[model samples]
Target: MTAAVVTGLGVTAPNGLGTEEFWKATLAGESGLGPVTRFDAAQYPSRIAGEVTGYAAEEHIPSRLMPQTDHMTRLALTAADWALADAGIDTGELPEYGIGVVTSASGGAVEFGQRELQNLWSKGKEYVSAYQSFAWFYAVNTGQISIRHKLRGPSGVLLTEQAGGIDAIGHARRHIRKGFPAVIAGGVDAAICPWGWVPQIASGLMSTVDDPARAYLPFAAEASGYVPGEGGAILLLEDAESAAGRGAEHIYGEIAGYAAT
Candidate 1:
């Protein structure tokens, strides 16, 4: 069996924007949970959440893509770019068919869907963008990343909620074992808008406490429910032998074993 190793990481987390920043804050016991500012949540039962602060999409994404993509897709694209750069991958030098992408999503792009629906009802059906046809799909992240980087190898998207990220990585490893040299495998999710909140609230698993510190205490005596958050991570997964041949730096770890029920 070919060993799959992680060569790079890109993180857009509530606590930090990059891997180094996130790790430092986590070690110091810092918290990113706070009152929701994406929208007016005063009337909602859950008023607080972990939002990715200080992120300006304009800085990371091209202006042309702004109109077509949602908040989550933008973040995913930026994360994928960062991961590829971190891995020192020069797509121009490698065979495009030898690289692949596999990611996971939970709720798709509710923010974009909500906006399109508003336009449809307020104006007319013609006002809705054709991009809306695929923007809200759960596989949009994987498709967008693949298109952006021109990775023409085996690609796929998994939708197993929290376990989806791991499943995607496992699938990527399978592809690598099948002879692909490199793969981008991870997950990114952002559904912190009104339409997205509706489903989370309906699930009855969201924390109602407004206090950030007191909320989202899982497996504790004071545990209520959990706080919802936006942002996730992307990672570069490469075959171990191929990584060594290319003089790849920063081998974080290996996917020693994976099994799913």
Candidate 2:
């Protein structure tokens, strides 16, 4: 049996954009929490959020394509592009044998939610955008990602709560065992829409703190739920032999054993 290996990886975590940048901030214990700039919180009870800083959509993807997609899809596509390029798995010439994509997310099409609600509340029924019907669906990220890469091989999505993101990779590995030669698998999230966040206020999970460090306390003394977070990590998984043949570098780890019980 061929061992599953990670040849290339990318992430858009709350800590930062890019693997290096995220890692640097993470190891240094840097916090990304701040006032919610994406929305005017004069009415909302909680004002703090974990916003992604310094990530320009144009920098990650082309200008023309960015407008047509949601923030989460943009994030996943950008990371997937970088990961494939890093793996040197040039699909431009590869004959269609079998490839796959698996990804996950906690919330979907948040901005779509925000816009539609705003349009309805502020401008009444006539101003609603037509795209809202499909954009807010849970499957948008996987669909957009697969379409962009032309990876029509095989696709699946995991939405197992917060654990869904971690489980998506294992699903990809299973596909490889089932005969897929290559699989792009990972997950992402962008559930910070102000309208969508209205439920959180009732749920009583968010922080009311204005100070950054004191705002979001996940598992510490404060431990009053957690601040919403966004972004994702992707891994390129191929048979160990195939990865070595392609000369991909820096094998991260192996999916040797997993448990759910």
Candidate with the greatest lDDT versus the true structure:
1
TM-score of candidate 2 to 2 decimals: 0.89
Worst 10 residues of 2 by lDDT: 91-100
In terms of TM-score, the best-performing candidate is 1
Models 1 onward score TM values of: 0.97, 0.89
Report how far residue 142 has shifted in candidate 2, in Å: 1.2
Clashes of 1: 0
C-alpha lDDT of candidate 2 relative to the true structure: 0.77
Clashing pairs in 1: none
lDDT of each: 0.90, 0.77
**lDDT minimum window of 10 residues, candidate 1:** 87-96
Off by over 4 Å in 2: 93-97, 120-130
Residues 1-261 of candidate 2 have per-residue lDDT tens digits of 767877778888878888888889999998878778877876888877777767788887777666556787888888888778777787654446466788888778788777778889999988877667766766777777777777877788878767877698888888777766778888887877775578777888677777778777666896656677778888888877776776767677777855563
Q: Write the per-residue lDDT of candidate 1 for residues 187-235, one digit (tens) a residue.
A: 8888888998988999999899888999988989989898888888899
